[model samples]
Target: MSVNTFNHRWASVILEALTRHGVRHICIAPGSRSTPLTLAAAANAKFICHTHFDERGLGHLALGLAKGSGERVAVIVTSGTAAANLYPAVIESGLTGERLIMLTADRPQEMIDCGANQAITQPGLFASHVTQSLNLPRPTPAIEARWLVSAVDNAVALQLQGTVHINCPFAEPLYGEWDNEEQAWSEALGDWWQESQPWLQQPQSRFSESQRDWNQWSQKRGVVVCGRLSAAEGQQVAQWAAILGWPLIADAQSQTGQPLAYADLWLGNPKAQAILQRSELVIQFGSHLTSKRLLQWQNACRPQEYWLIEDRPGRLDPAQHRGRRIATAVGEWLRQHPALPGKPWAQLLTELSSAAHTCIEQRLANEFGEAQVASRMSALLPPHGQLFLGNSLVVRLVDAFAQLPIGYPVFANRGASGIDGLISTAAGVERATCKPTLILLGDLSALYDLNSLALLRQSSAPVVILVVNNNGGQIFSLLPTPIAERERFYCMPQQVDFSHAAAMFGLHYRQPQDWASLYQQVTQAWQHGGVTLVELKVAETAGAEALRQLVQQVGAL
Candidate 1:
């Protein structure tokens, strides 16, 4: 019996289809059942394979690869508990519109739910989280090769929206290979086999909305808002705003994070809020914004025209406005609708922004602390480097105080916003793009993804992980909780030093004392040619307390 050939051929066809559609990276987790997929991927010259022992980290690794490479990346894992571990990254991919393909290996059909060690129900496993799902039977010659190709093509087409889950059940003898002549192919497939293209090419619609009222909308008092855009796109949006004489208020996740002079803090100022509220039209590009004040302003102000430009379909409007959600690429939308001549409608808004920035700079000028570090974050990174922002207090701190370096692409997992797997995701990004990476995370987040530090040693790019050790969750201080109960319940302080962790992982470690030395070391680490861990220790209550007073003073303005 040529069962091994059948299984191998099926796996080859599936992988070939994915590559034809421009997927080049495959993340693999070790398991016996997933042998067909692992072997097939390793044998293929087209795929850049990444292997991880932990499936959970592997899922996030694929997510980060998709984010960094801007292509559909696949993951291979065995069935049972391994398949369930992929749920976190799958859910994140769904929310953020990342393209991920999960190929899980399951036990054959007869291994029923009654009694099986590593077998579980495979159908509809990811539920609605993935855009498409496909379950394949064990190697069968009854189904022609063309049918398999078409099925894979059909399923992968939906990857543009989000994730695609393909479950393959392998009947064992999972080892030895066989001859190619056993499987039959059609004349059409013979032509397809020679070409490096998808068997079925589907046409895509150019755009969702027409360019009918672009001129009218462009002439109004418009404002540009950004949420999680690529660096190049954000810069173009910045240019578009400048050409139209509108102010650009970008979120923390935006590739080129022009912080709108710390919009999160300054928006509390009545004078600043009033000027922004006067905006007649608001055009928000992308989704998953980080600024609560800006989102609140959009909801409360209720501008005459609010247009959201995104490629994906669904309700991206958190403001719940009767706004037009234009389903199109930002570049295409900008191309179709050219802006009018540069006209300075409100120059005072720029002055207000500058004033707010000056007030923040003067306040945090004293010592080398978390707030100071975050405030000067834009200047902290070395030129031509990449960034990954962590969740919890650090991201909020950056959003509130720092303006990210212009033209440097920033990546984050804001969809789920959980602190877990952050280091793994960042390590994946570092591997995908061989550029110097600067990573910022709070103590708790660093601890949560501590296991992922092992992934860091493999990256060829220079990495600087700036762990702001606040000893606990500083975000709790912002909430209205009693001081007594908040200590252990809410804050959860873990006073473990990360230098020991860095040493255990064989990474270079440093503890920068002051801002001048901190900035010097961080920027220098980019040229250091290896992974360096830089820890900036501060009191647990420092960040939350400083921010409160800073905003209070800004509000008084």
Candidate 2:
């Protein structure tokens, strides 16, 4: 009688299918069932594997990678609670329309009834939060190979809408050696092309709307406010803005080119009072927007018509009806809106924009603190690298003064704005693509997810994190909470040195006390290195004043 031996052939097939689909990086949390997948991924020279102790951070890392690369990235973890750890990033991805693929490894269906260790009803765990969910069985080489390809294709497709999940169930014999790696890869690749029907072509539709002529609805005082968008998307929006003779008001994540008739798109929050009041029409696209003033304008001015162009409309603020949702792509809407003759609106908006930018530039020039650190770092970021701006003070300061050097891809979590797993997501971005990834975060955001730095050990792209350590949660001061109570609960300031944390995780770390030194160090770390941290200590009160001053200047404009 011949004895049947178990092998990791199934995992190799699954990993190969993902690699074939252009998934270059995978963030993994250690577990028995996930071992085969991780090992196979690690062995594949084309694929990078990032290891994280926390599954939550792993999920965010994958999201960050997806945002940076503009390609869907996956997260691998054990079943049961391990799969649940991906919830935070899943929610963020769903709300912001981020393309993140989550791969949770689980025990076979039979094991679920027996109460197996780390086993639960994994199906539908993230169904509500994700665009779609799928599960595949670990079968023999021939069957599993086909399933692997199908799973990868489905994951990529679902990512177009938002987040997607693929749960893999391994029966037994968890680990072994694969005798034929080529056979596994060929089978999966072949099956995917042959059997899996591609849904690549989403037929473009002509935009139909009531107001074909934007001039009919509003005159020379028009404003273009862009949210988070890809480079291609930004260009499309910019072209549209040019045709309409509207001045652009862009967020750092908006991707809209600078000097859009307006000297700076991000003049400290697009929703600021001054900008919104000056504009008669406000057309918004993508997401990553956190402007209280915009919401206030929507309620107060109640413009004749506030048009929202989105692939999926009626999602942005349910309470307000000041804007009617136009179910069409921004590019399509812009193409249909008749071109404007003069640059009157553009000129007025530009003057205001230039004044605001001048004030911000002056403040940044005078200060060598955390507030200036963000703007300074923004000035230094590579023109084409991916930037993952962490939430809290970092994002606000970036919003105030940081202008994305032209041609860079910028991303952030503005849907729910939580500092839980930013670094993890950014690390995921670094691991998944060959491009340079920069994470500009405050000390609070860094401390919130310290486990993310540990995931850097397996990344292929160079990741440079600028940690603006203001000692505590400086953003808390701007809020309405009581100082002492807020300091303890909301701020929760901890004096954790990122240097020691990085060393503990076997990563690189640096402390730059001045602007020149920080700039030189950051430039070196970002240009050539694995994963490095540049920590800067600044005064919280002064940083807050700088941010407030930026806001005031934008309001004055």
Worst 10 residues of 1 by lDDT: 180-189
lDDT of prediction 2: 0.69
Instruction: List TM-score per model, in order.
Output: 0.96, 0.81
Model 1 lDDT at residue 131: 93
Q: Write candidate 2's Cα lDDT for 1-557 as tens digits.
A: 00012235566656666665567767788888777677777877777666677888878877877766766676788778999989999999888766777878888788887966888888888868888877776555445445555666565654555777888787666655445444534454554434324423233354566574656654556666677777777877776677667766677777775543123232333444455566766677765564444344444655555666666544574436476677666666666665565454546456666666677678678778877766655666754578888888777766656656544677777777998998877776665556677788888888888876777776676778878888888888777878769878877778777788888888788887777887787688767768888788777567877766667666555
Estimate the Cα RMSD of every predicted model relative to the unseen true structure.
Answer: 1.8, 4.9
- Residue range 1-557, candidate 1, lDDT tens digits: 47777788778888888898888989999999999888889988999999888889999888888888888899999989999999999999999988999999999889958698899998798999999999887867677888888888888875666899999998887888467655564333687767897887775664555669788888888888888888878887878888899888889777655836587877777887777777888889888888767777767877897888988788788778766888788888888888787696767667766777888788888856888888888777757778899998888888888887666888999998988889888988887887788899999999988878888889888899999999888888988888898988988989899999999999999898888788778777876678999999997788888788877877777
The whole-model lDDT of each prediction reads 0.84, 0.69
Return the lDDT, model 2, position 372: 71
